[model samples]
Target: MTLKTCSRADGHVRAFPLARTLPLLGALTLLPLTSQAADQATGEDAAGQTASYETTEQAPRSEYLSDWYNQNVTIIGSKNIRFGPQQVDDIYLEYEFFGRKGPWDLYGYIDLPKFFGTGNGADSGIFDNGSPLFAELEPRLSLNKASDMDLSLGPIKEWYLAVDYIFDWGHNSNNRQSTLYAGIGTDIDTHTPVGLSFNFYKRYQGDNYGAANEDQWDGYRAQAKYFLPLATFGNGAKLDYVGFTNYDFGSDLGDRDASRTNESVVATNVLLYSFTHLRFMAVARYFHNGGQWNDDAELNFGDGPFHVRSTGWGYYLGVGWQF
Candidate 1:
């Protein structure tokens, strides 16, 4: 018996202008780091209320970020989207449940995806046509207040240890990769409606796409998220920005002599508007050196030079309802 592997004879490659914009982008990205350093130098504590900023966890009145719905469900749909070389219309739905009990905080969410179509020649099926019924369920546990560990310093208002587990099941299980991760998270005082967090993660991967080389992929990941308010609409309506940046230091694969191995970054900046229980979002996304899934799809199972530029940009608009 033999397997018919798809050849990259028609694969496309695009020029990455990353080198030209990196310097400017680098400066903007350093803002949080610089602020964190300055706060530490001045011994700024998140204890008392400052003139400009307050924290979600330490405020006397308990101000929850976004609306104060402890347990909520969100369903969003995106269409007429441009993602890298593909034009895709997909539907996304998610549910989040959060709670605090004793000394521990638990939060979890389930994400579901349904792909309708793709414009490019890429496969459209959940397994082939570039679209997959990709879905994930992740639960996170935080232990900071429970352990009575004073992990705060300067603008580093609070620090906690977290353990997360992600269960993936979708399509022909092409996206079936579960992950277990442990890491430390920190919160800092970045005035305005913008909040900042920097965290590090050590991840262990599970089998996927009939590949069981999960052991060869234990590595570190650095992640950050920001929340920025843009403007106010009528009544309780407001416009805001929230997104994250991530870099994964994936383990070496195949021969080490390959030109470009693994090292990828994903960043998204979103503009969101809220009106009552409904919200709308428009986001610009950037991907560098491809992410794990792209890497997996581009892997050459046969003999040939594998070339796929993982850098690209995309745009998406979505609407969601909260209950």
Candidate 2:
């Protein structure tokens, strides 16, 4: 029998043996498996591997339940950014990774933002020649997956406990700050995908990892994310939207003289268009960083946290490849 093969954009090929025996739907169905296993970069269709394939001969389920999570990575850039409470003019770039290993769901990202200025202040041109870098790591342990048990409670598909850690430095401050988070999260996979989580965080600042903090705080933060799909363009192009928000209610500040509540709200909306593995995204963001930990005394950052406004909005446009 002659084999028929088709190539995906990522240079992965799928072979079909005896095309006459395979219906078009079956053949198309097989396309994604090979395509996903081939690229492994751009995220796969969440529901693509769930269907069963059948013919004169029986076919197995398209996907096998695995002990590991699928690996996905996305890199993005945002330019002409303007955002608030602490109005900032900067260019931002971020690289995010998501994956599962054993019973752990690992996710995190690195960010670098080049600040041009605050746009309206004495320090308006302060960051004209510099950029600050940030990095985060989160590895969550899923009780249901680890124990091979279905721990669904009502509409929740899966529940896990996670620790999130973040570090930031570089913009001329030799000192860095590390924030640690502990939380529980649930995934709701209804018609739309949603994530909900609550976490407690504490931050430490200094040149060393365990250095004493000039300013520290403990707080609880709640976060939510929703995925919305728009229209599908011809030939597999798609428009998608995601809205994410986080609210922090700080309980205490280590600095005895600090009076601000350290409470804050941050929200972002991202609209993205994807063709093959390439994506173009537009982002709008709102920030109200009510908690400022005296930057001048702690990090010697000048006006401390007093320089930033109480609220502001920002925008960005960027292109990226998912791999």
Candidate 3:
């Protein structure tokens, strides 16, 4: 018996400027601390000492940087709502620094945001969402983008570094490719009720099978994320928003060719709930990309010219655990 395949395409590109602004609007909606406190109350004593002593143990306290290295693990999965339908699978390992004197953390993970199940020679599904399709053609679906494995290390106080390896096994073209990456980021917390971070990264790809013009490429990226706390849900739930963008520069060709540029943006909103042993988070994301190198057609498919570009919008939800 022959197996039937899902007809959805893998990567379809669309643009919406309004969707990019939603995350910022959500960030501005966070409730103030005073309002959050009003949601719950306890009996008070006439003696000030009684009030102070009673709440001391429950008050939120600053954590030392050294607290980041304790052993822990996290797993997450996400599904997209677009026509082609995409999903992301991730696994992470974490460790914290000793003694809480300073915060230090190290983590690593495997990320598969797109995977086409085997059927009709496609690794994901029947249609390729990342492709530009003509209405009359039977959509030709390609395998998922690829897999990424990464590691991150940080001194929790302000700085962090991340390294990643991306693997591309071209299911249809019979080609393979890889890239090595490194990045750095910093955080600032002087302002109350808000926090900010900035990050930058670079990547280098290995040689293509035989195409001289597409043999290799190098690029850079920059991004930022922000946080704001809102009213708690019972004991430890808060609403927050995060946003980031990546800008790429340098050569889109091999060692001797002139460079090409690329850029992409992602915005998200999350409702975060913390527990003694775990943390629950739900997030929505919007992504967009532009530039010559951004189009799928510019993609180097190892042996020859492959018409493909990287641009789109997608979202995800996740949960985390702490030890």
Q: Pick the candidate with the highest TM-score.
A: 1
- Candidate 2 shows a clash count of 9
Q: Which regions in candidate 3 have their CA more than 4 angstroms from the true location?
A: 1-67, 70-75, 81-105, 111-177, 207-217, 240-242, 251-261, 290-310
Candidate 2, residues 195-264, lDDT tens digits: the string is 2333333333233222233345456666665555565543445665555565766544434344233555
Write candidate 1's Cα lDDT for 25-133 as tens digits: 0011111111111111111123332212222444421232332223333433332222222233333334444434454444444433332222233224333433232
Task: Estimate the overall C-alpha local distance difference test score of candidate 1.
Answer: 0.39
Q: Write the per-residue lDDT of candidate 3 for residues 1-323, one digit (tens) a residue.
A: 00000011221111100000111111111101011111122322333111111122345221311122222222233333221212222111111111111232222222221222211222232134311111111111111111122222342335555443433333332233344556765554544755565556676555222223333445665545455555443333434333333344554442443222343444444444433334444444443433223334343435655543324544333444434
TM-score of each: 0.62, 0.61, 0.46
lDDT of model number 2: 0.39
Root-mean-square deviation of Cα positions for candidate 1 versus the true structure, in angstroms: 11.6
Give the backbone clash total of model 3: 29
Note the residue pairs that clash in candidate 1. 103-146, 123-129, 123-130, 124-129, 125-129, 290-310
lDDT of each: 0.39, 0.39, 0.30
Q: Pairing residues by index, what is the TM-score of model 1?
A: 0.62
- Scored against the true structure, residue 236 in model 3 reaches a CA lDDT of 39
